[model samples]
Target: MRGEGMIKVTLVRGLAGKPEPHIQAVKSLGLKRVGQSRLLPDTPVVWGNIKKAFYLLKVEQV
Candidate 1:
């Protein structure tokens, strides 16, 4: 199991045809293309962004 302080977010879906804000959220998470991944801090702000773009991403504890 991974610790609580970090998360791994991967872009599993494409951003084309998505809403502007959703695209922004994905970019803000540092994912620019499908299969891209980022290790980010586990905070409410990040969580909110993830939730907003949840359909385009896969998230796991890191």
Candidate 2:
């Protein structure tokens, strides 16, 4: 859905040695590497995931 309101999530830190759940959360957000970013729907579920991996990510409104 082009032009839909969303949040941008960027992997700001490496996931090396992170816990499984945190790694999963980053992957769930479609982040594959440090500096990788994804535009995701502005929803609570997505927000929850971001919160779970807050240490590894940078989030901004888009």
User: Could you tell me which residue pairs clash in candidate 1?
Assistant: none
On the 0 to 100 scale, the lDDT of residue 44 in model 2 is 81
Write down the lDDT that model 2 would get. Answer: 0.90
Residue 33 in candidate 1 has what lDDT?
Answer: 80
Against the reference, the lDDT scores of all candidates come to 0.91, 0.90
TM-score of each: 0.91, 0.90
lDDT at position 4, candidate 1: 60
- State the lDDT of candidate 1 residue by residue for 1-62, as single tens digits: 33368999999999999999999999999899899999999888888899999999999886
Q: Whole-model lDDT, candidate 1? A: 0.91
Error of 2 at 35 (Å): 0.6
Off by over 4 Å in 1: 1-3
